[model samples]
Structures are given as structure tokens and as C-alpha cells.
Target: MYQKSLVELAADLQKGAYSSEELTRACLQRIHTHDERLNSFVTVTETQALTAAQAADAAIKAGTAGPLTGIPFAHKDIFCTNGVKTSCGSRMLDNFIAPYDATVTQKLLAAGAVMVGKTNMDEFAMGSSNETSFYGPVRNPWDETTVPGGSSGGSAAAVAARLVPVSTGTDTGGSIRQPAALCGVTGLKPTYGRVSRYGMIAFASSLDQGGPFARSAEDAAVLLGAMAGFDARDSTSVDRPVDDYVAQLNQPLQGLKIGLPKEYFGAGLDTAVGDAIAVAIEEFRKLGATVTEITLPNTHLSVPAYYVVAPAECSSNLSRFDGVRFGHRAANAQDLQDLYTRSRGEGFGSEVKRRILVGTYALSAGYYDAYYLKAQQVRHLIRDDFLQAFAQVDVIMGPTAPSVAFKLGEKADDPVSMYLSDIYTISVNLAGLPAISIPAGFSNGLPIGLQVIGNYFAEARLLNIGHRYQQVSDWHTRSPQGFE
Candidate 1:
């Protein structure tokens, strides 16, 4: 039951092989039994999940159930869930219960998917590794001692452990793909504005986009179909028609033109991980696709540009948690100034504070043009690079991360080293294009991911290509030892 993909689970529910309630209970039981070791979930809504499962069963009986009906999934803690703690792995929101559902929550619920809980994540989506999470780091299920890649690490880890078949995650500079690679799950970051941002806690407004993590690309497509669409409530939500992601999963990849950015394969990529990606690309070639060496010349500037832009936006968005309206408040305050300073100081974890401070400095009057403005200008160059590449190729491919999951504390003290973990993925976000990371192979018993990038609003195409690759590969079906 735990190993079944979302599509299989849905088929089971439709055929009455098992009641939705039974399936939901099994998922909840698994979480209770195995999650302590993984520390993947921040909250478990057993009662709510059971109730939703009952409703889904009722819907199935009434012949109105959808594809996601009764499927148990988790939301990354960054999304606001009505009446549930919406902590973004930060002490600031530890006591905050959202008064409303995030757009993603509402859509999934309407589709009849059962929510088991909220998964843990990096503090306000700030770090590349899960160590910055205030709830504690999420250990990779593959090798317990290693770090699950961040921000979306908990979501990826949950799916990898089969705690849930699929989970919601937000990508801001590789949050979704990085962890998906490390945890050996399928993760997707849809084109910017493809999914609504309404009610999702803001990290970097422009860079943050919610996506999904699942065992396979097929499962991911099903969830993405339900999670995406125009939302007038979110100013950034594009009014473009949502693609039927699942409907395109079986599309053939023959004659597909794949671009391999020379820069990505050069320095920084780990040898084993790069080799795994090389094999994955050859498999694609065997499927009748042609691979070409393409160049995204400005790739080198992505990290520096992302650091400045993301932090700048985070500083502005996180300013609301200053203890005035809600969230954690300092118990004793000398005055308003003391209250604001002490509350934020105590509320945010170190990484969050570091980003906020850096963002504040970048946006400060004297440095605005020197830092933030320069980063934005560089962002355009990154976006243009992708546009230029797409003119000659159907998709671009690369190693999702520089290497496989490292020991939990390996790069915690070295922020720069940790940032490079996302060096291959940040460019996608900077370009506002769709991208996915699927398990390609493993190194030293840990997983590596192959990243596939596509042009704007090309999620369906990306998922299709991923689904085809998965048909000939079993990496996505592999599970962590104890968990299986």
C-alpha cells in the first residue's frame, strides 16, 4: 500500500479494492511508526485526514471521485493550512494557526485528496540543506546521517520514505529539485506564475513557486493537474490555461532535442553524480532523442544573483513577523523597538536572520543600485540564456545537484559550500521556467537526480519526457532500505 503510486492508489479506491479510510489509516500508521527517525512531518492531522478520507469514500460511492480522491499527501509547512500550525520551520510561526487555507490546500481538498500533515522545511525556505529548520533537520531516509536537500527537504523525504505518495513543495532557488535529487524522489518546479502563490508564506515572491514531490513523474503529473490553474486572488498567478499534466505523460520522446549545457557538466559537479547523469542521458538517447552541447553562458552568475534577489525579497516579506499582529512575541519588551527587535531576533533561526540582514543591506538606499539592482539585471541575462537555448532544443538536461546527499553537518558551517548544492538548479528559478528532478542513479547508497528544464509553461512537456525516461528506469521505484 505504501509503495503504490498516486495513480495506482486512485485506481484501487475506484475499484473498491480498499476503502479510502483504510488507505488513509495505513498512511497515518506508517507516519507514526517511521517518521520519528526521519523527522519529516511537522504536524500530523490524523483526525482531519480520517474525516477527509470518509468524505472521499462517499464521493467515490457517489461516482464523482476524481483522480486524486482519497490520495494521502503532505504539504510543506510553508503553505498556510486553516486551523493548523503553518510554521515555515521557524520559531516565529510556531504558534501560528492559519485562519484560511492556502490556494494549493483548497484545490487539493476540493479534489478530495486527504492531507495527513505538514512536512518540515528550512527556516522560511532560506537554506540549501534542511539543517536550518527550527524543527530540526530532516534526515535523508536513504542514509539517515546525511542531510536531505533543503527548503523542500521534508516534502521530498516524506515521499521517499513512502510516508505519503506525494507532497506539496515550493521552489525558490532549487528548494524542490535539490531535495528531490538527494532523497531520490520525483520533484517538479512549474513555470513561475503557473501555480498560485496566494496564502503560501512568502520567501522570495518572484522566485518562490509551489510544486509537487512524488515517487514517479506519473504521480507528480496527477498532483500538478489538480494544484495548478489561474487564481485571480494571487496577483502573480498567470491567467494562462492550465495544461492537463497527466494526459501528456505517455507522450513519446522520439526525435526530442535535448540540450546539455557545457557549463553544468564542467566544474563543481561531483564525478559519481555526473556519471549517473551521463548514463541517464544515454538512456534518453537510446529512446531516439538527440543530445547537443548548448551553452547558458551566464550560468556562473546565477548563484550571486539569486543570493541578492532572493534575500532582498525575503527580508521584505518576513518583516511582517515582527510580533505585532501574530506569531511569536518576546515575553518582555522595554518598548516597541525592543519588542520588534527582540521578537524577530528570537523568532528567526540564524539562516533566516542572515538572509534578512543581507537582504536589508542590499535594499538599503546607499547599496540598492549596487546590489539589488545589479542582481536583477543579471537575472535578465540568465532568463535570456534559457530562451536562447530553447530556440535550438526541446529541453535542457543536467545533474540536479553537484553531488549526492552529504553528512548532515558537512556543510552547515560553510554557507557558501551549502549554497553550491543548488548551483545547478537556481538558474531555472531565475529564468521562471519549468524544471523537474527525477532519480537517475545512486552513489555510495545515496541517490542522484537528473534535472530536465523546459521553456515557460512547459510543465506538461517536461513531465512527459520524465515519464518516458521513468518507463525504462527503476530508480524512481527504489525505496530507502528500512522504510521499504
Candidate 2:
């Protein structure tokens, strides 16, 4: 019962196979049994969850429930949940309870989904691995010694461990996809502006978009449908009509054209991951989809360009944490500068601080043109490359990460190495394209993910592709042993 996909669970609830309270209790029980070592959750709202579940069960009995009614899901700590401590995985917001709900959270509740807990994340959503989280790193369920990719690591870990069937994750430069790949789940980073950013903690505001993590592409589609839409509170939110994502999940892939980027298969990519993605492409061909080799020449510059753009925006957005309006404040400061320095120094983790410094330097007066402005120009080139490729292919395919989950501390000491883990994913964000990571295969007992990149607002097509693959393979349904 615990292993059921969210879609199956929702159906079961609708048929009275089980009440929402029973399902919620089972999930809470699973979290209690497994979360101690996983450290996936920062807070578990047992009472609130049960209350919500009971209401969902009553609604279903009354024939008034929505698709997600009685379904349990977790939220990344960065999303502001009313009356809950929306820490954003930083000590600065440790004691800060939000005054209101984030647009995403509010929408999920409206859909009758039960909020089980808040998952841990990288401080200010700033790191590639969960190691930078103030709550401590989220260990990959595949192997306890490996780090789940971040800043959505905890969300991925929770889903992977069956603590929840689905969860919300915010991606800024690969946070959601990378972790989902490592943890063996499906994650979608929707086209920028497709989802509202209102009440979500800022982290490279231009790049951060909240999406869903789930066991299957169809489930992700349902969650995405619920979470997406225009919100007047977020100026960047797109006013486009939301599509019926689940309705398109069964679309045939017979005439689909998938482009395999040459740059993504070159040096630095792990052989195991490469082989797995190659096999997935072959599987796509078997599904009657056409595969073609394409080139995105500027792909090599993605990391450097992302480093400049993400950090510069981050530095500007993060300036609000200067011991002024909200978050942590320093005690007994002699002067204003001391207060600012000490508060930040005490609140942020090492990676967050490093990014702040790098961002500050890049955005500084003398260096803005050399770094920030130049990266913006390079970003346009990357976007142009994708636009050109999409004219020839229906969707793009590649390995989500260069490799499988690495040991927890493997890249912690080297920030540059950590940044490269996001090489494939950062480009998607830069282009503001929709991309998803689905469990493709495993190597040495660790999961590898196959990424599907689509044109702007092409989430439904990506989901169709993923759903077709999932129908033929059980990779996405396979979970790490001993966790359940």
C-alpha cells in the first residue's frame, strides 16, 4: 500500500479502498520508522496532517474531493507555509514562522493534498549537494554514504524512501533534477514563470521555479497541474492558461523527434551514466520515436555562465537578510556594519557565504561588465542554441547529471567540482525551458537519470515521453532496498 504511486493512491481513496486518514497515518508511520537516519524532514505536522486527511476523507465521501484529495506530500523548507516554520534551511530563518502560505502551498491545500512535513534543503537553496543544509546533509537512500543531490535533496530523499508519494521542490540551477536523479525519482523543473514564486524564499529569483517530485511522470503531471497557474502576487507569473497535464500523459510518441546533444556526451561524463542514457535513447527508438544527434556548441560555457548569472542575482536578492527587516539579527552589535556582518556570518553556511562573496564580486561596479553582463550575453547564445535545436527535434535528451550519486563529502571541499554536477541542468534554467529527470537505469547499485528537455511550456510533451518510457520499463518504480 505504501509503495503505490500517488495516482493509484488517489484512485484508491476515491473508491473507498482506504480513507485519507489511514493513508496519512501510514505515511506518518513510515516517516517515523525511517526518517531518523534519513533526516529528510525538518518538521512533521502530524496533527495538522491528520486533520487535513480527515477533511479530505469527508470530502471524498461527500463526492466533493479533487484529484489530489487525501494524498500526502511534503514541501521543501523554502516554501512559506502559514503557521509553520519556513526555515529555507538556514539558521537565519530558523525561528521565523511565515505569516502566510506560499502560492504553491495554498494551491496544494486547495487540491486537498495533505502536508505531512517540511523537508530540509541547501541553505538559501545555494548548494549542489545537501551538505550545505543547516539541518545536516540528506543521505541518498540508495547508499547511506552518498549525498542526495541538492538543494531539493531532502524532498527527493523523502519521496525515494516512501515517506511521501510526492513533494514540492524549487530548482535554481539543477537543485530539483540533480537530486531526483541521485535519489531515483522523477522531478520536473517547469518553464520559468509557469509556476508562481509568490511567498517562496528567493534564491537567484530569475532561476528559481517550483515544481514536483514524484515516483512517476504521470503523478508529476498531476502535481504540476495543481501547482501551476497565474498568481497576481508574482509579477513574473505567466498569465497563460494551464493545460490538462494528466489528460496528455497517454499521448503517443510515434512521431516524436528526440535530439541527443553531442556536447553532453563528451568528456567529463561518467561512462555508466552515458551508457544508461544511450540505452534510454535506444528504448525511445524502440517506442517508434526518431532519434537524431545535435550540437549545442555553447554548452561548455553553461557552468561558467550559470555561476556568474545565478550568483549575481543571488547576491542582489539575498541582500534582504542584512539584519534589517526579517530573519536573524546579531546580538549586542556595536555598529550597523558590525550587525550586518555578524548576523550574516552567524546565519549562513559556508557554501552560502562563498556564493554571496562570488556574487557580490561579480555584481560589483568595476566587474559587472566582465562577469555579469558577459554571462547574460552567453546565456542568450545558449538559449539560441536550444531554439535552433528544437526547430529540428521535438525534445532533447541527455544524462541529467554527469554521474550517479557520489559520496557525501566527495565534492564538498571543491566548489568548482560541485558546480559541474549541474552542468547539464543549468543550461535548461538559463534557457527558461521545461526539463525533467526520470530514473533511467542504475549503475553500481546507484540510480542514473535520463533528462528530457522541451521547448517553452512543453511540459505535457515531456510528461508524455516519460510516461511512455515508464510504461515499458520499471526503472522509475524500483526503489532502494531495505528502506521500506
Candidate 3:
């Protein structure tokens, strides 16, 4: 039951091959038996999940169930789930139970998808390695000592370990795709505004976009169909028609022009990972796709620009949590100012504080022009570079991360090294384009992901490209030895 893709699981449920209650119990039992070693979930909603499954079974019997009916999936902790602890992997909201559901949560519930639990993540979605999580790092199922990439590591790990068939994730500077790369699953980062942001904890509002993590591209397409749509409450969500992503998954890749960014193959990329990417490209060529080298001239500037822009927005968005309205508060405050200072200083983790300080300084009056403004200018140039490249290419292909999963503590102390892990992915967020990472091959027993990035609102096309690749390869089907 756990090995099936979401589409397969849905089919079985529709055919009455198994009950939703039985599948939900299987997942819960797996979590009980194995998640202690993985630390993947922050809260498992056993009673709630069982109740939802029962309702789904009734709906199916009544001849009124959706595609996602009774399919259990995990939600990233960043999204608010009414009555569940919506900890964004931080002490600041450890006790904060959201009173309302996030738009994503509401949509999935309406589709009759059962929520199993909330997955772990980097605190406030700040770090590349999952180590910044206040719940402690989520260990990769492939190798427990290594960090599953973050801040979506727990969701990625859960999908990879087959604890759940699919899960929700958000990509703000590679949060969704990076961890999926390290954890060896298919992860999609939809175009900015493709999914609503209402009730999702903001990281960098402009760069943040909610997406999905699944074992295969077909599963991702099914999940994204339910998650993508216009929502009036979120001012940034685009009022565009959602495509039938699942219907287009089997589209052939003939005549597809794939761009290989010259910058992506340069310094710092591991040879093993690069070789894996090359093998994946050859597989595409056999499928009748043409590969061409393209230059995204501003690719080198993405990391610095993202660090500046993301933090600036995070600093602004996180200001709402300073003990005034919601989130953590200090006991026995001397005054208002004292309350704000101690609440924030005590609630936020070290990495969150570091980013907050950096963002505050960048947005300060004197430094605003020199830092924030310059970063925005660079961001525009990066967007322009992608726009230019897309004119000749159907999609851009490259390595998702520079290498396979690194040791848990390797880059924890060095923020610069950690920031560079997302070098290939931040530009897509800066440009507000859709992108995906799929398992290409392995490097020293660890998986390497090949990224397929498309122009704005090209998620359906990207899904087709990934789905075609998965049809010819078995990497995405492979699971951790013991877990399998």
C-alpha cells in the first residue's frame, strides 16, 4: 500500500480494492514504527486522520468523491492547519495552534484528502540543511547521519521513505526542490502565484510558492491539480485557469529544446553529480529531445541577491510575531518594549536571528539603497536572463544541488557555504518561473536530482517533461534499502 503512487492509490480506492481506513492505518503504523529514527513529523493527527478517512469512505460509497479522496498526505508545518500545531520548525510557535486553515489546507480537505501529520523543516524556512530546525535536524532515510536538504527536508524524507505517498511543500529559494534532490523524490516548485499564500507562514512573499513532493512526477501532477487555483484572499495569487496537469503527463518530448546553463556546470559542482546529470540528458536525447548550451548571464549573482531580497521580505513579514498579536510571548514583561525584545530574542533560533539582523540592517535607511536596492536590480537582471534563454529553449535542465546530501553538521557553522547549496535554484524563484527536480542517478550511493525549469506558468509542460523522463528511467522508483 505504501509503495503505490498517489494516482495508483486513488484508483485502488475507487475500485474498492481497499478501504481508506486500512491505508491510513498502514501509514500511521509506519510512522509509529520508523519515524522515531527519522524525526520527520512534528505532530501525527491519528484520530483526525482516521475520522477523515471514514468520511472519505462514506463519500465514495455515495458516488461523490474527488481524485484525492482518502489519499493520505503530510502537510509542511509552514501551512496553518486549524487545531493542529503549526510550528514552522521553531520555538516561536511551538504552542501556536492555528485557529483557521491555510487556503491549501482548505482546498485539500475539500478534495477529501486525509492529512496524516505536519512534517519538520528549517526554522522559519531559513536554511539549506535541515539542521536549523528547532526540532533537531530531520535525518535522511538513505543515510541517517546526513542532512536531508531543507527547509522541506522532513516532507521530502517522508515521501522518500514511503511513509506517505505525497506531501505539501513550499519553495522559497529551493526549499521544495533542494530537499527533494537530496532525499531522492520528485518535487515541483510552481510559479509564484500559481498557488495561494493565505495562511501559509511567509518567508519571502515574492519568492515563496507552495508546491508538492511525491515519489513520481505523475503523483506530483495529481497533487498540484488540487492545490493550484485562484484565491481572492491572497493578493498575489494569479487569477488564471488551472490546466489538467494529469491529462498532459503522457505528452511526448519529441522536438523539445532543452537548455543546459553554462553557469550550472562551472566551479563547485561535483563531478559525480554532473555525470549523473549528463546521463539523464542522454536519456532525454533518446526520447527525441534536442540539447543546447545556453547562458543565463546573471546566474552568478542569484545567491547574493536572493540572500538580500529573501531576508528583507522575511524581516518585514516576521514582524507580526513580536508578542503583540500571536506567537510566543515572554512571561512578566516590564514594559511593551521589554516584551517585544525578550519574546523575539528568546523565541527565534540562532539562524533566524542571524537572518533577521541581516535583513534589518539591509533595510535600514542608510543601507537600503546600497544593499536592498542593488539586490533588487540584480534580481531583475536574473529574470531577464531567463526570459532571454526561454526564447530558444522549451525548458532549462541542470543539477538541482551541487552535490549529494552533505553530512549533518558540515555547513552549519558556515552560512556562506550553506547558502551556495541553492545556487542553481534561486534564480527560478527570482524570475517567478515553474521548476521541478527528479531523480536522475546516484553519487556514491546518494541520489542526484536533475532539475527542469520552465518559463512562467509552464508547470504543465514541465510536468510532461519530467513524466516522460520517469517513464524511461527507474531512479524515482528506487527507495532506501531497508525502507523498501
Candidate 4:
């Protein structure tokens, strides 16, 4: 049951092989039995999950079950779930209970999926490592000593650990894919605006997009279908028809043109990780994909550009958290200003503060044109590079992260190193393209990911190509030793 994918679980439910209650209970039992060491979940809604499961069972018996009916999963803490804590993995919102469900939450619930709980994440989705999380860093299920990539590390860890079949995640830069790469799970970051962001705690609104963490590309397609679609409530949400991602999973990859950016294989990428990606691409070749060497000349500037744009946006988005409103408030305030200062200072963790300060500085007077404006220009160049590459190829592929997961505190003190962890992923956010990180192979006992990037709104092709590659390779099937 734990090893089953969401699609497989859905089939079981449809076949009446097991009740939703049984599957939900099994997942809750697994969380209770093992979550202490992983620290993956911030809150587990056992009662609500059971109630939802019972309803799903009834729906199935009444012959009204959808593809996602009775599929149990967890939400990233950032998504607001009515009557449940949506902490965003920050002390500032630790006591916050959302009054309404996020669009993603509402959509998933409408499809009859059962929510297990909300998982831990980097504070306000700011850090590269899960270490910055208020709860605690999520340990990589593959190797407990190493960190799971953040800020979606907890979701990745939970899926990798078989605590959940698939879990919701948000990608700002590489939050979803980085952690998925490190934890050896299949993670997708949809094209910006492909999914509605309403009720999802803003973390650099322009860069953040919600997707899912799953054990396989097939499972990813199933979850992505249910999570995507337009909601008029979010101004950024595109009014495009959602693709039936699952129906296209078996599409052959013959004659598919794949671009391999020469810049990505340069100095920073780990040799073993690079070698693993090479082997994976070779498998894609066997699946009839034609790989070509290309240059994303502006790749070098992505990190610096992302630092400016993301922080500037984050600074603006987070301004609403002042003590006068909802969320944590300081008790010993001498005045309104004191309340705002102390509440924010005491509420947010170090990484969030660092980003907020950096963001504020970038958005400050005089520096705006020099920093933020120049970064936007660099962002345009990055997008142009992807556009040019796409002119010759259907999708671009590369190592998702420079290396595999590092030890928990290895780069904690060195913020630059931590930021560089997302070097490969941030560019996609800048370009607002859809990208996915699927398990390619392992390096030094840790997982390596081969990222598949597609043009805007090309999620179906991305998932299709990934699913085809997965058919020939079993990397996504490999589970952490103890968890299996």
C-alpha cells in the first residue's frame, strides 16, 4: 500500500479492492510510526482526513468517483486549508489558521482527494536547505544525515519516505524540483500562471507556482491534472484550458528534439551528478530523443538576477504581515511601530529576514534602477535564451542541482553556497517556463535529477517526455532502504 502510486491507489479504490478509510488510516499510521525522525509534517488532520475518506468511499459506492477520488495526499504548509494551520513553515504564522481553502486545496477536495496534513517547509519558502524551517530541517529519506532540498523538502521527503503518494509543493526558483532531486522523487514546477496562486502564501509572487511531489512521472501527471486550472480570483492565473496530463503520458518520444545547454555542464556541476544525467539522457536517446548541444549564454547571470527580482517581489508580498493584522503579534509592544518591528523580528527566521532585507534594499530608492531594473533585463535575456533553444528543440534537459543533497549544516553559514544550490532551477522561474525534476540516478548514495524544461504551458509534453523516459528507466521506482 505504501509503495503504490496515486494512480495505482486510485485504481484500487475504483476497483473496490480497499476502502478509502483503509488507505487513509494506513497513511496516518505510517506518519505516526515514523514521522518523528523525519519531521516532515507540521500538522496532521487525522479527523478531517478520516471524514473525507469516508465521504470519498461513499462517492465511489454511489458511482460518482473521479480519477482522483479517495487518493490521499498532503498539502505544503503554504497552501491555506480552511480550519487548519497554514504555517508556511514560519514562526510568524505558527498560530495562524486559515479561514478559507486555497484554490489548489479547493480543487483537490472537489476531485475527492483526501488531505493527510500540512508538511514542513523552509520559512516562508526562502531557504535552499530545509534547515531554515521553523519546525526543523527535513532529513533526506535516502540518507538521514543529509538535508532534503528546500523549501519543499518536507513534501519531497514525505513522498520519498512513502508517507504520502504525492504531496503539494510550491516552486520559487527550485523549491519543488531541488528537494525532489535531493530526495529522489519526481517533482514538477508548472509554467507560471498555469496554476492559480490564490490562498498560497506569497513567496516572491512572480516566481512562486504550486505543483506536486510524487514518486513517479505517472503519479505526477495524475496529481498535476487535478491541481492545475484557472481561477479568476488570482490575477496571475491564466485563463487557459487545463490539459488532461494523464491521457498523454504514453505519448511516444520519437523524433523529439532535446536541447542540452553546454553552460549547465560547466565548472559548478558535480562530476558524478553530471555523469548520472549523461546516462539518463542516453536512456532518453534510446527512447528516440535527439539530443543537441546548445548554449544558454545568459545562464551565468541567472543567480544574480534571481536574487534581485525574487527578493524585490518577496519584499512587496510580505509587507502584509505587519503586526496590526493577522499572524503572530508581540505582547510587549510600546507602540504600533514597536509591535511591527518586534513581531516581524521575533516571528521570522534568519533566512526570511535576510531575503526581506535584501529585497528591501533592492526595492529602495535610487537602488531600484541600478539593481532591480538591471536584473529584469537579465531576466529577459534568460527567457530569450530559452526561447531560442526551444526554436530548435522541444525541451531542454540538464542536472537539476549542481550536486546531490549536502549534509544539514554544510552550507548553512555560507549563504552564497546555499543560494547557488538553486543555480540550475532559478533560471526556469525567471523565464516562467514549466520544468520538472525526475530521478535520473544516484550519486554517492544520494539521488541525482535530470531536469526537463519545456516552453510556457507545455506541462503535458514535459510530463509525457518524463513518463516515456521513466518507462525505460527505474530510477523513480527506487525507494530509500528503510522506507520501502
Worst 10 residues of 2 by lDDT: 475-484
lDDT of 4 at 21: 98
| Model 3 worst lDDT window (10 residues) | 475-484
Taking the tens digit of each residue's C-alpha lDDT, what string does model 2 give over 1-484?
A: 8899998998999999999999999999999999988899989999999999999999999999988999999999999999999999999999888999999999999999999999999898988889988899988999999989999999999999888999999998999999999999999999999999999999988788999999999999999999999999998999999989999999888989999999999999999999999999999999999999999999999999999998888888888998887889999999999999999999888888888899999989899999999999999999999999999999999999999999989999999999999999999999999999999999999999999999999999998889999999999989888876
Once superposed on the true structure, which residue ranges of model 2 sit more than 4 Å away at CA?
none
lDDT of 3: 0.94
Clashing pairs in 4: none
Candidate 3 residue lDDT tens string, 106-137: 99999999999999999999999889989999
Candidate 4: misplaced stretches above 4 Å? none
Name the lDDT of candidate 1.
Answer: 0.94
Which residue pairs collide, candidate 1? none
Candidate 1 error regions (>4 Å): none
What RMSD does each model have against the real structure? 0.7, 0.8, 0.7, 0.8
TM-score of candidate 4 versus the correct structure, residues matched by position: 0.99
